[model samples]
Target: MGLNLRAAILHNVTDNDQGQLQDTIVDAISSGEEKMLPGLGVLFEIIWQNSSEADKKEMLETLEQGLKR
Candidate 1:
């Protein structure tokens, strides 16, 4: 299969501004459809790659706390 999900996702979001990106995340999460997970994961991957060590640690802590709920 020649399908590259990451490239496709990035292409779709290439022109998105901050507000548009926020809406994309909010919509995907609020909808809670299983299909949205891959997109969310791709977004997270981008975020993770760009984040600093401290930011990554904070995100991990926040995720850990949320998972306990």
Candidate 2:
């Protein structure tokens, strides 16, 4: 089977603590590298999959507000 980018990225960070996860996200954003986007998208997908309706709503609202700025 071909290498799965999403699975690879998720597995790479699966054991991370909250602080480590935050650092990974911050580093990815601060570096402003397009290559980092897939990893971030994977992380977001995980979050979206596990989130409750209210949590998803809040996230959407936050994203919408950020985009409007």
Candidate 3:
């Protein structure tokens, strides 16, 4: 189920705008909805796996801001 969802997200995200898609996913995770949290570990792992130091920093910052909201 996770792999399937991830694949679908990847496809859908890449099909339109890459940057906004990335932000949307990150925002979803940061929101920490009950349903959103189930696969969050995987998403976090994937983000850290693919992100550079700067990107990771930005992601963390974004997460912090989201938490405040």
Candidate 4:
């Protein structure tokens, strides 16, 4: 099979604590590297899958607001 970026990102960070995860996210965003986007998308996908409908709505609202800025 071909390399799975999402699976690789998940495996690499599976053991990360909350602080480590936060740092990783902050660093990824601050770096502004296009290559890091897939990893962030994987993280967001995991979050979306686990989130409740209300939580998803709130996230979508927040995303919309951010986009408008």
Residue 19 in candidate 2 has what lDDT? 99
Query: Comparing 2 and 3 by TM-score, which wins?
Result: 2
lDDT of 3 by residue, 1-69 (tens): 246876655565555466775677788768878776535555577669999999999999999999999
lDDT tens digits, residues 1-69, model 2?
799998899899999999999999999999999999999999999999999999999999999999999
How well does model 2 score by local distance difference test?
A: 0.97
lDDT of 4 by residue, 1-69 (tens): 799887799999999999999999999999999999999999999999999999999999999999999
- Following a full C-alpha superposition, what root-mean-square deviation does model 4 have from the true structure? 0.9
26-45: candidate 1 lDDT, tens digit per residue: 99999999998999999999
For candidate 1, what is the lDDT? 0.96
Q: TM per model?
A: 0.95, 0.94, 0.45, 0.95
Higher-ranked by TM-score: 1 or 2: 1
Q: In candidate 1, residue 49 scores what lDDT?
A: 97
Pairs that clash in candidate 2: none
Off by over 4 Å in 1: none
Supply candidate 2's per-residue lDDT for 36: 98
Q: What CA root-mean-square deviation does each model show from the true structure? A: 0.8, 1.0, 5.2, 0.9
Best by lDDT: 2
Residue 53, model 2, lDDT: 100
Candidate 3 lDDT at 44 equals 70
